[model samples]
Target: MSVFADLHRGDEPLLLPNAWDHASATALAAQGFRAIGTTSLGVAAAAGLADGASATRDETLRLALALGSQPYLLSVDAEDGYSEDPDEVAEFARELACVGAVGINLEDRLGSVALHAAKIAAVKSAAPDLFVNARTDTCWLGDGDGDGDGEETTARADAYQRAGADGVFVPGLTDPADIAALVERLHAPLNILYTPTGPTVPHLADLGVRRVSLGSLLYRRALGAALEAAAEIRAGRAPHGATPSYDEVDALSRRGDLTHSDGP
Candidate 1:
């Protein structure tokens, strides 16, 4: 396993936060997060588009180019490889690899599991060095665990693993037992989406999960915070949280480089 893959093997599942741009990614890396992921929703929203619907290919690439030279490991959330055609998806994978991304989260949210599987295989074939975290959406869209248990969750994850996925992700899973069972059945590493009700990092590690992704959770929360701050200010009330200084953000963007007269 690659060091990135090895990081997920510990009892503590790696907690991967998704960033939308260079500054967000650099900030997280500065905070000592060894691995950072890109959020499709954030990228799509920033481009005035919808996510998980095959939009924002160029925008995703633009963001990748911006993030490629950052000092942290990057995993990109490229929804369905942005096409149904396997060849195109594989080419996309090659491009992500060229940009120095260490991981890619490819999902089957739009149906056509076989096509998604082909995409996964193609990405792995083209970029053997990149970690391919395959995602199955049975619980996110189907009737998995109508009673809210995790049994049905395992079946879906298993299917993806059988298709040659390095790891399987279930975005809407929350129950701990369900998570543990899914981990048990999933031969490949299991990745769960983090929810307020879901197991925390330590709890997930105990459940045998290898990875936990924030998905669009952070981006949505940031949007929520922005709305709340604006509302509070409009209501003549002070914001209720600590805010980062402009200097801090500028530093994340490497102001020293911009101010330099010599080549970096």
Candidate 2:
């Protein structure tokens, strides 16, 4: 199995942190995260594009090309494969794999089950080695306790798995009972989106979650910190939090040089 795929089989759930750019990804790697994922929201917000609207395909590819040769593994958040057509989605997945991405996240957005399954199959056919984490937004795009939605979620997850997904992701699934039940039904590893109000990482692991993703949480926190720092400065007070030195920040930009033997 690939190194990225092996991460899902480990004893502890893979705590995958999402990064918005090269600096964020490198910084996370410096902190010892072996794998990093790109958040669609962060990418869209940075480029002033709409998230989940399939508008950042080129930008996503550019970022993947930049970080593909880095030391750590990369899993891109390719929202709905950036297109409805399965072949186009497969082509995009192939491009991501070519750029060194070891995995890709494709969300269904509670859309057609057959269509999403076709996309998953196509992606696997196109990039056989790329780990496809098939995501179903049944719980994500809705609200409530999700009392009677478990069957629907399981059905969709099952379909994706049959379509050749390496793993299954349910973004808004948090309830312990619900998660454990889903995990029991899934043939593939289960990935849960980490939330502050939800079960802790250890708890999720105990519940049989193979992976935990902090989707957009880090990016949102970084933005919050920047806003707070600016507010404090305007108020004539020093900003709070652990701020990296200017040189440290500069060093991240230069870190890319180490990737190539000859300097750019």
Candidate 3:
């Protein structure tokens, strides 16, 4: 198994925090997150594009290239692999692997199951070592807790795994019973998206979740904090959080480089 794969088999579920840019990724790595993921929403929003619409492919690749050489492991959220063509998606995955990305997340968006599976298989064929977290939007796009939805989720997950996916991600699944049932049935590692209103990390681990992804949560919270900070300044009140000094942020920008240079 790969190093990234080993993270999922640990005692506690691998808490993968998604970063938007080089600074955020290095900052999270500085704080000791061994594996860092790229958030598609964060990437798209930063580039003034839309998420889940196959936009921001270049922006995503750029971010991956910027951060892939960093110390932490990188798992990019490719957002349907940026195309409907499985071979095209596989080519993209190959580029990511060449730049040192250890994993990629491909979502179905409740589209054609066969096409999604084909993409997964093609990615595995192109970048055999790259961990593929096949995502299905059944829970995200449908009624998550219904019995019929659970069956659909299971069917999709099964198909994805058979197509060479290293793991399965169900973003909108929150109910503990449903999560446990899915975990029991999946042959691949079960990845659950961590939500504020959902089961706690330990609870998910107890339910047999191998990976817990903070998908867009940290990026959204970071944006919220910036807004709140500006509001507090306008109101003549101090912000209520640990603020990093200017030099601290500057240092983060130069992480992994032997010496800092004034020119870009």
Top of the candidates by lDDT: 3
Per residue, candidate 3 scores C-alpha lDDT tens digits across 1-264 of: 999999999999999999998889989998899999999999999999999999989999999988999888999999999999999999999999999999999999999999999999999999999999999999888865523388889999999999999999999899899899999999899999999988999999999999999999999999999999999999999889978887777777774545675633
Candidate 1 lDDT by residue in tens digits, 1-264: 788888788757888999997778888888788999999999999989988888888998877777876777888999888988888988998898898888888888747766777788787888888888988776777665422435545555555666567888888777777777666676888888888876677888888888889888888988899899999999999998767887767667663335623332
In terms of lDDT, which candidate is stronger, 1 or 2?
Answer: 2
Q: How accurate is candidate 2 locally (lDDT)?
A: 0.92
Pairs of residues at least 3 apart in sequence or in different chains that clash in candidate 1: 150-178
Candidate 3 runs further than 4 Å off? 144-148, 255-264
Give the Cα-based TM-score of candidate 2 against the true structure.
0.95
Ten residues in sequence with the least summed lDDT for candidate 2: 255-264
- Report lDDT (CA) for all predictions: 0.80, 0.92, 0.93
Model 2 residue pairs with clashes: none
Model 1 lDDT, full chain set: 0.80
How displaced is residue 191 in candidate 2, in Å? 0.6
